[model samples]
Target: MTAPRLKIFSGNANRPLAEEICKAIGVPLGEATVTKFPDGESFVKINENIRGQDVFIMQSTCTPTNHHLMELLIMIDAARRASANRITAVIPFYGYARQDRKDQPRVPITAKLVANLIVAAGATRILTMDLHSQQIQGFFDIPVDHLFASPVFFEHVEKIGMRDKNLVVVSPDVGGMKMAAAYATLMGSALGMVWKKRTSATTVESVNVVGDVDGKDVLLVDDITETAGTLINAAKVMRAHGALSVRAAVSHALLSPIAYDRLKGGEIDELITTNTIPVDPRGLPITVLSVAGLLGEAILRIHNNESVTGLFKVKGF
Candidate 1:
């Protein structure tokens, strides 16, 4: 039997990344009309027929989170109603991911709620990269294709020849030790960590560095950074410990105004992140890598019913 036709579409959010993914996959983006109404309501219309076609809607729930999310839901609903064979919501940056659990009383697990909403909105599956919490996969009943940007970062590591130098991978906090360890192992570098305390929503205090970073170039790895408090504080601690230089590789950089302000302070020598969300470096020492190829490959594999295990492997480039 032949595979169903593949049709890729994009919402208003992160359309540039979606276009890049389409380019990588050698496919044209589907035609759709996504707009807003006078009352500030989302409106969606499919310009072409997609009946019996496998549909993938690419949208990152980034800035103006609710607007992008609603657009995604509406697009999925439109595809389902239009008789698409299957629909996959490709979210490069899954927002509200930080609220995966209820750490305190009277707080809602918004991440789970978002998962439920996606499932309820007629998404047959989901494809996302570097979720804030890995456990968010369990929240959905449908299959979730979780991809990582580590391969992209590893490529950058090779491009800069960091693999040949004395290097250490540092986690910004204890919770991110596993991610740091993976990076360190892949790069053949030592592992370190910074103990941090969250003083407020936008402030983090880095208490101490766990491993020796003296005279070594440091790479701080984290899943996501918004205000950059954790990264800046951790970089400061690493430098104070006699590290020659401090750099960071984060999966997602949801940089706000405060983050840009902090970056100007020279706490870190460079900040490497993915194009999962829209980011502007503002002439700062920030590098944005595109994950479109990685995501495009997974989309092709998933559509072909082939194994996607190789996407996780980090081979020397």
Candidate 2:
């Protein structure tokens, strides 16, 4: 026998999620101690030896983003020095991915920079879900597994049952039309777009609506929603254009202060998203589905050296 190969570890960010993933994968979470010092510096120590073992570290850089990211780097570095055979960063949500490109001069390509940091920290591979940009996958020199949360989201939407074939998948802006179009094709519905102009970080103005949305149940699709400006603006336009009901499906909900403030006022009917970030479904008008099971399955297959292409399918959606 080649011997048992997988060892899963988690940093301080989302241990509850890590444990859930471990349960799905049929493995115990590797013991590790992560803490902060008085000066607010990070400290990490692997409680169990991982020599010659394939180590997967689960850490989502959400909330206290920089601190969690640093913990992941430290853990990976520790794994490398501990002689782990291969270290795969199982980042269900990659932070700093929105800065994948510089539309203007003097801005840093932060997504690529984060990739370099992972490589420098001795991570052999990366696995993440629904990045802000697909091209971010190319930023890595090491192999990357880019998974999508669509299958999980589609399952919920399919169960709740859409109203009719007249459903329209609306993209909040031109940049997200590709994802929206895919949803449209999957649902056997039409596609539409809202013309928006961003005024500032947390503010936007809706200019116009493209294509037909009259008397259709609208599904607004986007990769992330931090400030809720884009989503609120788009939903307003979609509703004004005679959309019967407007619901949104977002992959990540970084729902900042402004987002929470505005979203609580009820612009969109139901906001569906994955728990790639910290989620509290209790108070908000949003519903969070666990991607833990999906991510867990992918991690198990990766550990066994099995094909993960199967995770990327839904014949209908």
Candidate 3:
């Protein structure tokens, strides 16, 4: 028996990342037409034959979330109908991930719903990174390859000499303590957290800090950031507590206009993030690292039936 050929396609969400991934894999990106109709309905047509081939669709459900998500689903459906042997959805940034639970009355778990939609669209596997919540993988009945941007962040942190700057890793909120602790452990830095109360849907107030950060170079870590309220507020609190410098390392940076304004307020000295979503720095102190090599390697491993566990190993100094 022969192995099925691997093909990769991209939606309008993050085509550049997809192209870079293909470059890393040394394969040409599968040709496809993914666009919206005049009525705003998505249309996808596989330009090349993919019958009996393993297919991967790369799309980030970022800004214009619903449109990009719909585009991904449509593309997956197209690949399935093309008789592809296997279909994998590569979502670098999974939108609606924050709505994974029913914290309020009569609200839907949109994250689970999104997962169902993908599986129903005939995706046999899922590849995503730094989801807002870990349990979102449980919503899917298929195999899920959950990757983290920490290793990539760690490499950059070392490159910039942040590892030896009296570094202390702090979670902007209690919910992200685990991720922060992992970074602290790997970097051999002190671990801390900020207790915050959500004043509104878009605002957050930092109540207290859990660990010592005085006179230390603080690094705030989180899986996602949109309005930047939580991070900026936490950085302010860290500075108020006598921290020498404050920086942020977020996996997904869905920076909005308000986030830009807050970032410019100087609470955070540098914002390090991944290119999971489209980010516009607008002349701020933002560093965007490409995860193409990381994702591309994972795609190849998946196609070749290899373990992706090795991708998680970050070299510590």
Per-prediction CA RMSD (Å) = 1.1, 1.3, 1.0
lDDT of 1 at 163: 71
C-alpha positional error of residue 201 in candidate 1 after TM-score superposition, expressed in Å: 0.7
lDDT, residue 157, candidate 3: 85
Q: Which 10 consecutive residues of model 1 have the lowest summed lDDT?
A: 308-317
- Rank the models by TM-score, top first: 3, 1, 2
TM-score of 2: 0.97
CA deviation > 4 Å runs, candidate 1 = none
lDDT of 2: 0.89
Ranking the candidates on lDDT from highest down gives: 3, 1, 2
Query: What tens digits encode model 2's per-residue C-alpha lDDT throughout 3-33?
Result: 5478999988888889989898789999988
For this target, which candidate reaches the highest lDDT against the unseen true structure?
3
TM-score of each: 0.98, 0.97, 0.98
lDDT of each: 0.93, 0.89, 0.94
Instruction: After the best TM-score superposition of candidate 3, give how far the Cα of residue 19 lies from its true spot, in angstroms.
Output: 0.7
Clashing pairs in 2: none
Measured with C-alpha atoms, the lDDT of residue 160 in candidate 3 is: 83
